[model samples]
Target chain A: MAASNEFRTCSVTGLKVHLPAEALIKANAVVAVVFLAVGGLFGLLVALTRWQAVHILPAEWFYLLLTAHGADVLLFWVIFFEVALLYFASAILLNCRLATPWLAWVAFALMLAGAAIANVAVLQGESSVMFTSYVPMKAAPHFYVGLIVFAVGTLTAVGIFFGTLVIAREERTYQGSIPLVTFGALTAAIIAVFTLASGAIILIPTFLWSVGLITTIDPVMYKVIWWGMGHSSQQINVAAHVAVWYAIAAVVLGAKPISEKVSRTAFLMYILFLQLASAHHLLAEPGISSEWKVFNTSYALYLAVLGSMIHGMSVPGAIEAAQRKLGFNAGIFGWLRKAPWGNPAFSGMFISLVLFGFLGGISGVVLGTEQINLMMHNTLYVPGHFHATVVAGTTLAFMAFTYLAVPLVFRREIVLPTLAKWQPYLFGLGVAGISLFMMGAGTLGVARRHWDITFSDAPLTFEYPPAAILMMGLNGMSAVLAAIGGLAYVLVVVGSILFGKRLDAPDAERPRFIPRLPTTVAAYGSAGTLHVPGTIVLVTVFFMSFVLYYFVNWKYLSEIWPMR
Target chain B: MAITSPEKRVWWNEPLHRPEVIWITIAFLWGLLMFGMMVYWHVAGRQNLSNEAYKVFPEKFAEKVEDMVAKYKVREEGATKIPVVRPPPGSDVYVLSRLWEWWPILELEKGATYRLHLSSMDWQHGFSLQPVNINIQVHPGYDLVLSITPDKAGEYTIVCNEFCGIGHHQMIGKIHVVDKK
Candidate 1:
C-alpha cells in the first residue's frame, strides 16, 4: 500500500490527500462496519431475550450474549469507526500524511487481536460476567488482558491522531486553526487518552486478581474506577458523533458552524467536564461520598450539558443559515422543508441530532441528578438513555457517513438508491422505540440485567406490573424493527461495495455509478445573516422537553422516599 | 469585500452574532441553575445518601446475620416466612445479603426514621426496593447505611437488582413497615 509518500488531491472536493493515509482510512472503516454488523446481531438477540414473550436465550446464554453484545457494540464497533474518523479528520482534511503508517497498522492489528481474544473469553463461559465485570466476580484473566490490549491499541491510534495534527501544523496545511470538525476530532482523541488510561489503571490489577497474582480486589473501588473507562468511553462517542454531525452538515449541506470559536469553546468544554458524566454511574453506589457524587454529578453545574447544547444549536443553526443563503428561505422552516430529504446522509444526521438531543441528552441530565438517579440507576432506564445516544445518535450518524464513504473511500456507487433513502428512518424509528419502551419499562421498575423479570422458576415468584410486561413486549417489537432496519443498512452498504458500478476519475465520459455529490462542501460561503429563528424555535422545544423530563424525575423521587 | 469563498472567511475569528451570544447566555444560565439545584438538593433536600458508607469484615457480618435470624422467627399461615426482626423505632437495623437471599425481614414503624445497614456476604448485590423504585448499589466488605423513614406503610419487596449469580433474580427481601403500636 505504501509505494511512496505520494499525494493526490480529490478533484471533486479539492482536498490534497496522502495516499498511504487513504489505505488506513479504508481499512479501519471496513473493519468498523464488520464489527457493527456482528455487534448489531448480538444486540437483536439480547433484545429478543429481554422481550420475555420471546425469551430467545436461556439464562446462561442470555448473560453470555449480553456481555459480548455490550463489548462489541459499545467498545469495539464505535472505537473502530472513531479511529477511522480521526484519520479522516487529521490526515485528509488537513492535507497531511499520517505520521506513522507502520504504527497505525500495529494499532489496528492489536485491536483486531484484542477483540478476538475477549470474544473467545466470553464464549468460553467463564467470562460471562457481563461487560461491567464487577470485581470479586472474576472473569478469566484473558478478558481483562484482551480489554487492556485493545485499549492500548486504541490509545496508540489516538496518539497517532495527535501526531498527525502536529505534522499538519508544522507543514502549514492550512492557514489558521484547523477546521471546526477537525477540532472536534481532537476533543475526541484527548478524551480517548483519558478513557484508555483509566481502563489500564483499573483493569491491570483486575487482570492480576483473575490470574491469582493478587489476593483480593474491592468491588466498590473497581466500579468507581471502571466507569472512568466505561462511562468515559461513551463520552468519547459523544464527542466523536457530535464531530460527525458537524462534518455531515458541512459535507452534505455546505453548512459552517454558526461561530467556529463558539463551537470550539464547546469542544473545549467537553475536554474540561464531559468525563465527569461517568460519576452518574456511581450516584447510588456506596463507598463514594455524597459530596463526591453531588459535585461530580452536577459536573460543576452541568457544564457538559452546555457543551452539548452548543453543538446541538450550532449544527442545525448552521444548516439553516446556509440553506437561507441558497434562497431556500421561504418561511421559518422553508430551509428545513427544502432540505435534501432523499440524501441518507442529511436525513439520518438530522434525525440523529433531534433524537439525541431530546431523548438522550435530556435523559442524561435527569439520570445525572443525585436524588433522581436513585430512581433510574440499575433500571432499564439507564440503557434506554444510552441506546438513544449510542444507537440513535452515534450509530445512526456513522451509518450516514457510511453512505458518504461507499462513494469516496470505496469508489463505488450506493446500491438500492430508494432503499438507501429510507434506511435511516426505518432503522432510527426502530431504535427510538427500543429506547422509549425500555425506559418506560424501567420506570415501571424493570431490572436492567435480569434474565427474566417474571422469576418463574424461583421457589418464590414475583410478578411485575402488567404495564411492565406490556412495555417489554413493545420494546421487543421495536428491537425486531430495529434489527430489520440494521439489516437493510448492511445489505445496502455491502451490496454497494460489491455489486455496484464503479466510478471513473476526473474528466472521463463518466462511469455508470457516479456519486450524487461529486464533492463535499469545500468552498461554501460564510455563515450568512444569523436570522435563524427556526433553529431558535427547535432549540426551545429541546429546552422545554429537558426541563419537563427533569422535573418529572424529581417528582417521582419525591413520591418514592417522601419527606422526613 | 463581497466574500464569495467559505474557506477565505474563518468563522471563529469573526465577531459573534446575536443568535450565538443569546443562546450562549441561555445555556450558561441553565447550566448554573442545574448545578445550583444539585447543591441545594444535597444540602437542603438531604437527598441521595452517600456520607453513610464504610468497609466491614465478612465474618462479623455473617455472625450478625445468624443472630438476627435466630432472634425473630415469626411463623404465619402454612408457608414459612423468613424471620422478621422487629427493631425499636428510630434505631439502626442490620440485614445480611448472601447467595440469593436478603435475610431477617426488618419491620420498622411508620413516621420514624431508621438507619438500615446493607452489605453482601458474597460478591456484590443491588438494594432495589420495588414499588418505591429506589436502587442503591451494595458491595460486600462495605456497609451502606440507608437512612429512611417509610411514609407509606406496607410490605415492600427488596429485590437485588445487581446481577450477582445464577439466581440473582430470585434474591428478594421483605421490608414490612407497621404503625406505631
Candidate 2:
C-alpha cells in the first residue's frame, strides 16, 4: 500500500532506502556535523589551555569553555549522530518506511533548540559548573532546564526508533531476528532509555532546586544519580559504535560474524551489565560503602569485560575468516596484510578496534578496580583512558562509517580520496600519542582538572617531577597534531559531501566509486569452517599487553604506599 | 518470512564453532582469575582495599578539628598560623575540608595506626594525598574515616582532586609522618 515515491533502491547496497528515514538521517547527520565543528573548536581551545607552555585562557574562561567543549562533543555531536544511525538501521536497512516521521522531526527540533539554549547559557557565563555539575554549587535554572529539554527530545527520538522497528516487522522487511547490525542498534536504543531516564530523575529535581522550588539538593544523592546518566551515555556510544564496526566489516569485507549467536549474546551482555560502570565514578566517594564498591567493581564487572573481549576476538575473527576464505592463507598475518588498507572505512575501523582494546579496554579494567582506583581515579589518567575509548574507539569508528555513508547516502563521489585514505592514520596516531603522554603524566600524579600543574598563583606550592612536566609537554604537542588530523577529516568529509561531484549517471556508467576505489564489500569468496590463526595471534598480543600493563599499574600502586 | 541474506541464516542459528568455544573458555578463566586475585588481596591485606569508612555528623567533625587545631597552633603571623595537629600514635584524628583549603595540617607517628576522619563544610571535595596516592571523595554531610599506619616518615602533599570551585586547583592540604623512635 506504500506509495511508489516513498522508497527507492540504493544502487550500491541494493537495499531500498525509505525516503522519510533517509531525510531524517541526513538532517540528524548535518546537525551532528555542525555540533562537531563547534565542539572541535572548543576542544582546541581547552587543549591549548591545558598545555602548560600555552596556558591560553585565564581561569574563569578556562573553566567556562571547558564546560562548553565537554557538552557539545560528548552529548550533542555524538547523540545526534546516533539518532541518525538508529533510523538508518531500523527503516532503511529493513526496507520499510519510518514510523511517525512527523514526531521524529519534532524531536529533532526540540533537541536543536535545547542545544542552542544550553550553549548560550554557558557562554552567558552563569553555568560554569562542569559537566559533572555536582550540586550544592548550583547553575542558573535555565541551564538545568535546557538539559532536561534535550533529554526529553532524545527520549522521544529513541521511542521513534522502536516504532520504526515495529513497522519493519509488520512490513515484512526481513526474517530471522533482523540483521546483526540492527540487533546491535536495538541494544544501544535500550540502553538509551536507561540513560535518559537517569537524566530526568536527577536533572528535574536539580532544575526545581535551581528555580527555588526545593529547599536542599544533596550532593551525594545527586552524584549517585547523575553518573547513571553521564557514564551510561558513553555506554550508548559503545554499543552504537560496536554496531558500526560490525556494519563496516559487513559492508567493506562482506564479512559475516564468526558466530551470529555469540555476537548477539555479546550485545545482550552489554544491555544487562554495561550500566554498572557508573559505579566506578562513585567508588571512592564518601557515603558509599566498600561492599557496594567491591560488588560493582570486581566479579560482577567481569561479565561486562568478558562481553567486550568476546567482541574484540570475534570482529577480527570474522574478518580473518572471510580473508582466509579468499585464499590468503599463506601465513598467520597474510589475511591482515591482504586487507584493503587503502580504504579509510576499513583502516579506521581496524585502528579503532585495536586501540579501543589495547589501551582503552585494559586501562578501563585497571581503573575500575576498587583497590587500584585509589591511585588513578580523578587523575589525568582517567581522561587518557576515556580518550582511547570515546575518541579513539567511538569517534574514529564513526568517522570510518561516515566515509562510507557519504558515498552511499549523499549520492556524491568522494573528493580528495587520497586524503581520505590517510586521515585515519594521521588522526589515530595523534590521538594515541595523546593517550600515552597524558596517562604517563597522570601516573606521575598530575591533577585531572587543574589549569596549572605548577600552581604558580596558589598559596601553597608543590612541584611534580620534571618527567611529569615533560609528559604534559608531549601531550600538548600531540593535541596540536591531533587537531591537524581532525581538520583533515573535516575537510575531506565536509568537502566531499558539499563540493564533491554529483553522481546521477544511469546504471551502466555507475561505477561503485567514481575515483576507482574498491567500494564493494569484498564478496564472501568461499564458506569454510572459520580458520583464523591471524586473529588468534593478534588477540594473544592484546592479552599480553593487558596483563603486563595491569601488573605494572599494581607495582606502581605498591610503590606509592611505602607506608604499607 | 523469507530472510533476505542466506549467509546470515547459515551462521545465525548454527552451533558455536571450535574457535569461539576455545576463546570463551580462556576468557572465562581469565576473568575468574582476576576476580580471585581481588578477593585474595582483600583477605591478605595486600591491596589498598579499604573497608572501615562510615558516616559522621558534620558538626562533630567540626568540633574535633577545632579542638585539635587550638591545641597545636604553630603560631607565627596570626593570619597564616594554622595549626599542624600532631596526634599520638594509634589515635583518632580529624581533617576538616572547606572552600579553597583542607584545614589543620595533620602530623602522624610512623608505624602506628591512626583513624583519619574527613568531611567537608561547604561542597563536595576530594581527599587526594600525593606520594601515597590515596583518593577519597569528601562531602558536606558525611564522614569518611580511613585507618592508616604510616610505614614511611615523610611530608606528603594533599591535593583536592574534585573540581570544587575556581580555587579547586588551589585547594591543598598536608600530612607530616614523623619517626616513631
| Residue range A1-564, candidate 1, lDDT tens digits | 223447876654667778778888888887888888898898898889988889998888888888999999899999999999999889888878888989999999999889989999999988989889997888998998899999989999999999998988787876666887788888999999889988999999999888888999888778878999898888889888888888877777677776767888999998999778668888888778777887788767778888999988888888887787767879799999999888898889998998899989988888888888888779999899999999999999999888877776666778898888899999999999999998898898888988888877654556779999999989989988988888899999889989976753555332222233333434333344468889999999888888887777777776776422
TM-score of each: 0.95, 0.95
Q: Among all windows of ten consecutive residues in candidate 2 chain A, which has the lowest summed lDDT?
A: A511-520
Error of 2 at B94 (Å): 1.6
Q: Using lDDT as the measure, which candidate wins?
A: 1
Q: Summing lDDT over every window of 10 consecutive residues in candidate 1 chain A, give the lowest-scoring window.
A: A509-518
Residue A365 miss distance in model 2 (angstroms): 0.6
The DockQ figures for the candidates are: 0.47, 0.46
* Pairs of colliding residues, candidate 2: A563-B151
Runs in model 2 with CA error above 4 Å? A299-301, A507-529, A562-564, B1-12, B52-57, B74-79
